[model samples]
Target: MTIKASDLLKYDITPFLFGVLYSRIMPKPTDDSNPKHFYVYTAFRTSKAVLKTAFSLSKYASRLVQQYNSLSGYPNWEIHKSSDNAIDLRLYIQNDLNIDAAQFYNLVYKKLRSSTWLNTATINEDKKYFLRGYMESRGSVDTSLKLFAQDYFYNNRFELKRVQLLTDDIGLPISYANFNPRNMQPQFVSGENKRNAQFRINLFYYAKEIGFINEYKALIFEKAYKPRARIARDGIIYFQISVPNLNSHVAFIKYINFFTNNIYDKVLTPEKVGILRKQIGFNTSQELGQPYRNKSIVDLFDELSEDKCALCGTSQTFKKKANGRQSFEIHHMIPFHNGQEFDNIANFVKLCPTCHRSLKRGSASKDDQIRSIITILGRHPEVFEYTSSALGIEELPKLAEEIWSLLG
Candidate 1:
């Protein structure tokens, strides 16, 4: 109850935050004498993870948890943590409290979920954020030959028949995904080995309707996602997306390249790009080192700074390139496409290779963060001319004064 609304933004957690309100309440079981119980469960991999979960769980559920204990006159039912032989890497925490769970569960669920912050977050963006909480916790990209390979078609379309929604390893069709995962279990649904085909189809549809799926894949193109689901011969349910019109294998290659290009980042890593290059027989930009700037542009940037780094004041440059001369890198104060018409000296900052590379790593001190960006803008006078538009997030002139006062 002490949790402030603003503090909620510090962590990424979702729907289970709401779903617990709907599903975890159990009332008196045909007898009034029996104490009612409520349960909330979670898994954690590290000590910090466990602590964070405990804090979050208490923040979200503490009010109901307290009211139940107070009314029922029972001692607090603390969170229970344990590890089982069946699952490693995950330590479990379950709160089994004695209370009239059903009575308070509805009250708590409605009150919390109906809060303006949550009620307003009902669309695909909300769903995407909610799902990403899961993905960041446990999802991965499927870059296998089946998903990443060249296109195949059934009827003059770039068809990817049976694109998998979730691999069986992590246990998809879970209740969080709005599916009865139990349906795929051996003792459930008549021991059927496959289920949740509809869920998989919708999963792809959602991924496509949104531009990107997690941080790894994007929908290939507009009007290009057509999905179906089938129980594979191997008894696993697989989602299909084989309806995009692919005139040639070349077009399929282009789609894959575009996806790879967009998702390329330090997290995606150069090694994965190397593997995709070898396996898919195509390239995406180039391996992560540096973007190739024009030779004349680099020379001009170096001259503008008189061979000193605009960022860290580093002037050291080694004669390491094939030519006898040392080198520096030219950086854009604001990316060219966002506001600036083209790359030029007025929009550029000159940083020796060391400062430029170090900034890219992004694990710098606060002073470094502010000082470096300031240095870049100082060198690029054109940025001030378009300060209201550059970088696509222009602060109002009044807002700049407010920031200046705050800093003072």
Candidate 2:
């Protein structure tokens, strides 16, 4: 009998089966037409935790198949240690009932990637379980949460995009990064021009949404969410979460305290507070009450150029209207709506009112706008540096194209 899609739900193993299929290495199928036999082989390797999880899953699957189909035997399963000190877990299933292995694999694979399957009602739990299994197989938790698959997989880009869609459907937003071979880790590097498709989500979001099933991963995720504070050798107090690197400056300690206290309890105690206050020679609380001023875009532009338009060199005195103010505007090489992180001095440029208006969306001429953008980026190396870094664009022409699109 052919294995039907409904059998997945009938056996209550849709999520688990999909998880195994979506793993880093998918199941392999072998067929023997002479006697009408089929064999499915699934293998997994990496950590002991994954091995144990996969082993248990394999046994669970075997039991389910036996009970539901009333099979006389269970699927073969084994664990082996490789010469490289890596552990490998393998599961083999023989289907004598004439179930097509290739067809069954494709059916489950399609279900896993189907948008309709994701939107099905009462499947939230199943979705979480599916993600958990996939995470155990291919996910990693560090400063960020990442899920990756080798580039050689058939329709790898489509698969990665499906992952992004699944995460969004599950209410956890994830971003996809195209394969960059040069920056790939040694293990991920292989055949020429081969790379890996990666999906990244914020650690806090991952912890809050779909948590870990592996004991070690759970511990790491727990520790990462806890807040901690420390004093550096330079006499600066650093506040951090998940990783050791400092995220904010000493001036924002009060803000950090507020966040930690409200979210995870105050990480700093009264004793540590006293020590910090004494070392810094000030009450940390006062900084919160004091007004913190960041330089305005106009102010940043003035620092880089005279009180005139950087594009047309129109002096403020000459461009002054009846109100006695220059018509120069501060243009962002990278748009402000992208994020506040790009709201820095390097991304701002002073432009004449005419030049600024010409570069905006729905301008009269696209050529003029492109020329103006190229001129602004070429004149200011810092703007190019900041824009390129912010957008991850390398070449100036490509960066210019990206900026043009952002402007539109």
Candidate 3:
């Protein structure tokens, strides 16, 4: 402060200020071309944005302070204590982490308890991490925030349905399953059986999750249809069965649509198409064609990709390898094998290797499986017909003259 003007000039304030500003603007100097530099720069930028945005929210800031206080008051909570069990330690970690309301609720699935069940030490630990994340912008807050503001609300709703069902002493009903099937009664098993009622409830849950009313209708059909036989072997099997009546084929198509719809279009993308190739591993569908004894069946399916072992209800004799390649396979629905009376497309199915082995030996019967498939397809005749036609089946189940006709 006592130095003369000349001495101050000699000190060069401009250079010193310039150096300070430069250091403030940049990270510690390093190899400019390093790949790690990009990662560091990106992280720094993202963190800075989050901090800038969150700090502006007064609620976030206030929560941050409260969490910090919780941590300081119980500093010993963070230490791993031999006296405490694993559950106690985890709870402490959750508290130290400053997990939000959303995260705490989500922890119910993993921890099997609410925050009320957690010890004071653990709660303190959770609060600390949550606050640290908010203040320092070093960890996550979005997932926790979303959990609190949104997902938790839905969780409560699901719980409500469960509670209502339990309190009413009634099984969950398919009241919301609004499917107007052309041929079949969607609710086929509406009697005094508890298991049947429970099964319907289970289908309702699956239907809700998948977000398709039509599929749910098909599922109802599935529940109504009974399997003729128990599956015995894993090997490929062949089914030579009575072709579905026109009405039955139409119904079957509806069920098949659930599996094959958007199959080529949605599933054959670069991501999923690669999986088909992997599923076909090692053997070409072409290579397996020459070895089959069922020349008529082989001739019928030979034109299509062999990698797809199951065609027209036949199981593949070969395994689906890790590389996605397939080997020798068989077709269940053979044209020559069909009786002179019935030759419908719905008669066919694809079986994998083990299924095929059992079928060639006549260990399995096709009639048994067709009954199950037909029962499921009874609903949604429109979708079912479309699928069967695509598979080169000539006939389908005849539609009723009137609507609301009950089909079983």
Candidate 4:
């Protein structure tokens, strides 16, 4: 049956309809000569469920085109897998219901890039669907919930202010962080020297208000929010090394004077002394000296390796926690949760926090799980041998699959 534009308008789903269209729509060559021939297309690299929701929401826009242009069609949207295996949901819009393709393309698509449009007054009260659509297209969940804007979008202070205002109104106050081009690779910098803007959302308010419309994002959100095991005291203790004569109060002052170029009398206030103590090895109570202890297998591995993440090869020297210790997480290639037998050193892999989070079971995508297994096995082939011996799986692919299943 041909759905009329008027019938679709009666439902008042324009906020969401336009939101998806605005965020995901691709650029097409302009044909100023043919207004009636105006058509719009948008695609998403997302799951089938997200596409289905978009497909349902797009029907309204399709009906608008059908009724206005006097066209008849059962399904106006197309869903297919792209070459890279990502699902693509494409919508073709012609003519207008309340707003036309050109208006949407200009007011939304163009303005989103060149100017600000996401304000409380413009988006109206029912902003959840609109935010969901935008997030589904450009948002990501990791250590933090964030929405990415186009390069230099936040360079305009007015636009940044508007974004802040809008998010504040929704009760999900966001913090903006600019990605400086100097810190990025030269190849990544554009001619305008602009970098992408990131808006970090308040997770607590996001959970209460706008949740994810994409199933994959929802799963990742759950994992990102999941409580993690506290860093073991033994793990922290392993980094502690005793300094010679640091325990002697007189020697401590002498060492401090040497480092401070003998300006200790003038500059070393009690507060400065306390801070320096903590920076060295002193506990909060001003306790001095660390007892020598034998290093564990994990510590040995860390020392023997390049002091970098095994997966991404990022140097741990630069990635430090607030207390001034290097950040690293020990990931089990064959998780011990499957069996305590896999808890040996052969199964262990050092990962940066980001890579570790990406590899979490159940929450991680199948592709990530498989890729990690491949990367780990490539680095330490002994892991495969150990797993084969333990699980009785002979073939590499099959063994990897077994490990993947065990992960879940």
lDDT (tens digit, per residue) of candidate 3 on 1-408: 122222322332221121111111111123332111110000111222132332233233333334322433322222112221111110121122233333433332223122232234332323322222211221111222111001101222222122122112122122311111111112222322212111011222222222111111222223333223222222111122222211121222222222232222232334443343333221223111122222232323332333443423333344447545455453333232444212222333434565445444234454534443343245424234433433334344322111111211
Candidate 2: segments with Cα more than 4 A from true spot: 1-12, 24-85, 95-104, 110-117, 120-123, 142-152, 155-161, 168-171, 175-193, 220-408
User: For model 4, how many clashes?
Assistant: 0
Point out the higher-scoring one by lDDT: 3 or 4.
Answer: 4
Q: TM-score-based ranking, best first?
A: 2, 4, 1, 3
Off by over 4 Å in 3: 1-348, 357-362, 365-408
Which portions of model 4 show Cα errors greater than 4 Å? 1-11, 30-76, 80-84, 95-125, 142-165, 168-208, 227-408
Q: What is the lDDT of candidate 1?
A: 0.34
lDDT rank order: 2, 4, 1, 3
Which ten-residue region of model 1 has the weakest summed lDDT? Answer: 153-162
Tell me the tens digit of each residue's lDDT in model 4 across 321-362.
565657777777777777654555556677888888878777
The Cα local distance difference test for each model comes to 0.34, 0.45, 0.25, 0.43
Q: What is the C-alpha RMSD of each candidate to the true structure, in Å?
A: 22.6, 16.8, 28.4, 26.8
Q: What's model 2's lDDT at 273?
A: 45
- As a whole number from 0 to 100, the lDDT of residue 184 in candidate 4 is 27
Best by TM-score: 2
Q: For each predicted model, how many residue pairs clash, with residues at least 3 apart or on different chains?
A: 8, 0, 59, 0
Clashing residue pairs in candidate 4, if any? none
The best candidate in terms of lDDT: 2
